[model samples]
Target: MTLDRSRWQPRTTTFIVLMAAANALLYHAPLFSFAADHLEVGSFSGILTLVTALVALFSSTALLLSLLALVSHRLLKPICMVLAITSSIAVYFVATYQVVLDRTMMGNVQNTNLAESLELFHPKLLVYLALLGLLPAGLLAGVRVEKSPRLRVAAMAASVLVLTVTWGWMASGTWGWIDKNAKRLGGLVMPWSYVMNTVRSAAPKLWQSDVQILLPEAAFTDDEKSVVLLVIGESARAQNFSLYGYERPTNPQLEKAGAEALQSTMASSTYTTASVRCILSHVDSSSEFSTRYEPLPSYLQRHGVDVIWRSKNTGEPPIQVQTYETARELARDCPGPERDYDEVVLTGLEERIRSSSSQKILVVLHQAGSHGPSYSTKYPIHFEVFRQVCESVELGTCSEEELYNAYDNTILYTDQILSRTIDVLKRIPAASPLLIYISDHGESLGEYGLYLHGAPWMIAPDVQKAVPFIVWMSEEFTERRNVHPAQLQAQTAHSQRDIFHTILGALSIQSEVYEEEYDIFNESFSNR
Candidate 1:
């Protein structure tokens, strides 16, 4: 049965319409599913609203595709193929992880290093690409389109007017409902979600100044040696930590070492880049380039304080410091199996502090803690206190218990690392050490069908926003600063924004930019 190849060819307008319909139907399951779950399908008004929304979505997509296909005969097929392939990839992540491709999430995608991105690879992803991407793309490649530019242009203009009227009518009655779910709805629309958001996230970088606005001049209040070790944890949620009343003993080492856990603390954002910037910024500003200022590390370094940054993770803001070391760089001095883990960041830490000539020192250790879907691989085998852990990157394949055990073990490993760090600080009594640990953002583990972080912050669950804030100070540090552990722990309700001012207060650095109200250690204690 031989078929004529000429029969398969269609006009440009027809091809665009078919492609738009295919994309709306095939790649929009998540959007329609969300709509179905929220709308009252049993009622007439809800059904009408749903139908109108669907029509709007289809029409808008068709109009956009029509414009692209009509622009040039040479580039029509290539554009369609690219959209097909990219939409398939976008839908896979949106549906599998239940993540929204908002600006922050898109920023996360751009900021992800190759090693971190590789963790997302799974067999299911390949299946999606083959079926949804390559199949359509291959079909588009073989089809010949008959050009009818004038007719297509006329049809598209009519569509634009019709769609505009239809949207205005729909908005009069359903604007509130649509506005409420705009973030989720915008994030679920295939191709446009990642496409527009990537631009939205990257556009700000263009206007940002190359040089930071330097903060007011600061001076040390005392000549005493002070070292603040700020450990920026990655994807660590407070809900799982035993220190925050979790049933599991995930914080055994931290508890034994007498670390103070502040109960009320929320992350500023659900993603690392924004949350880390907030943690370092002088003010509690939204994730916008307009509010850019000197980060804590750079500000401290400029004030003659020795600042050393050790990172096992990416996504920290631009920093200006004398010493910045990555895990691979630090691996030379560190040996054995633990060297590959986050414990590698602690290589020669005590030696560095002892050898420093500055009276004030700040060492920032950015940890790759509990980054998901390969949680079981994050810690050593000995740290796997819980049994029957999930080893697969496909999170949905694992049972609830398996997923939890693997994630908990990472927290347990984190407990050990923090404890070991405390031990090192304890040995350096002359430096009057202080350890402050807080996650850049929290993680979501099968909560409300959400697997990983980076949902829009307004709608993200508490598990994704609530992070652990732990502090450990030596007796010398407490005495020199005239602060008590009980007083510090008693005053609750903290946030990542407080970190900037708290570090300044602890180091006794006087600056006009330092806000006393934001400093957690300044409740009743005086640094004078």
Candidate 2:
């Protein structure tokens, strides 16, 4: 579509200048700050590096905005104004906060409930909007950008080529190899960071839509009354727990409650949804993303076993489980604020237990376990065993000791939640109950200057990959499944794949999909 360029008002050109100035100011300071703060450089080299980064960032931004201006022609002002405001706001906070905006964080943003998102907004955010967005947007209001269409097109093309070449040349002259590639870190440079992330997140959803999973019929051998619970922990690392001999009494509640911690178990990934999806499915860990999976809960439900998936966490990708409730849903159905406590999943537990008339029951609690930045919020006030905790979202701003203090408190709170869950199980009259606890992935806690999980597994520290897997069962459950306590203690190495067959073996579920070799309990029983 061709655009008419007939208006030649002086305000039009002035509006464009104001908009361009606003754009440069909004992003320029942060680009300089990020380079000065993060990159290592000598005085002579540092100035050159910072200059190059700023030039590349500004020229690329100008190139894109100029092209949008030329193409939209008449519509450019309104569209560009909106984009400018949005970009300014995004860049301001991300640059001010010093955090990377990536796809995983955007997935979290997409899935977060309004109540949770509201917690993020404060008076400071409004100030940012006024300074970054409103000021420029006000200048852009009455101006119409239409006139000299041919000249505008030629100028835009020339600017794009010149800016593209200039950015490339500036990027090439950095002193070291790391500095040469430092421009890639420009992805963290605000509006573009989020814009790129949004594209990446959307691409995966489109690609994965065609995944089709077909499963054979499943069956169960019944008679023994039983209940099985799988607790999916969040951001917990095995090395921190006393159960793994960390020196800190992080597992005091679990130890006192006599929960058996499986000392050596590593998660396949370091992100929540990815790890949980793998553990709860039949897909191999190596090809978890590539292969389609029959949802574990749905598969169990079809076999006449009851299954319920309840969570207090957010950002779950679509799963096949029909019996699913997030913390928001649980809070609405029951009574409570939607806080980070994992106990929300236990709301109306007695009724749920009674409602399931089936002999076999599986209830999964997806916990907001030890999730970070504001780790103190994850637990009640009493759980603060470690002193002077780091309570800010900017984890890098805090001392390492303070960060650990806040983190350990969450683990302590998790131990409390787990203990309470076991107490809930003990109340049932006829059911032999069992609880299996494992974290979806571990956390970084300021290791190697990395503050969170989701680093590619190969380069990630063991603290990010190693997870705690624990189990507790009533005496009846132990006897029924032939679980020799001695044998469980002796078993050290295990994969997440062990969960499927272990649950089946425990329930005496007769199915072709069940692998006896994966069931640790089956080995002890076979020898007996």
Q: Model 1, 129: alpha-carbon shift in Å?
A: 0.4
Q: Report the CA-based lDDT of candidate 1 relative to the real structure.
A: 0.86
TM-score of each: 0.95, 0.80
Q: Specify the poorest-scoring 10-residue window by lDDT in model 1.
A: 519-528
What is the alpha-carbon lDDT of model 2 when measured against the actual structure?
A: 0.71
Give the number of colliding residue pairs in candidate 2: 0
lDDT of each residue in 1-528, candidate 2, tens digit only = 644343435333344444554566675565565566656656766767766655556555655556665665577677666766777667654543433556655555565566556545545667767877777676666455545454655575577568757766766657464454344364455456677787886677786755546567766677777888888899999988888888889988789878888757889776776677677766556784424656567677777777878988764445555378877677766555524367778887657877888888888888888876567788878788899998776677789899999999889888888888888888887788888988988988877666666655555678889899888978888777667678888776876777777777777687777777777677732211
User: lDDT per residue, candidate 1, 1-528, as tens digits?
Assistant: 754567678887777678767877889888888888899977876777676666667777777777776567668788879888998888888888989998989999999999988999988888889999999998887788888676765586577658767676855676677788988999998878888899999997898777888889998898888889999999999999999999999999999888899877999889988899899998775745425788999999999999999999998888999999999999999878878899999999889988899989999999999999899989999998898999998898899999999999999999999999999889886888999999988898898889989989888999999999999978887787777877876776888888998999989999998988788778743322
What C-alpha lDDT, on a 0 to 100 scale, does residue 281 get in candidate 1?
Answer: 93
Candidate number with greatest TM-score: 1
> Which candidate number would show the highest lDDT if scored against the true structure?
1
Cα deviation at 37, candidate 2, in Å, is 4.6
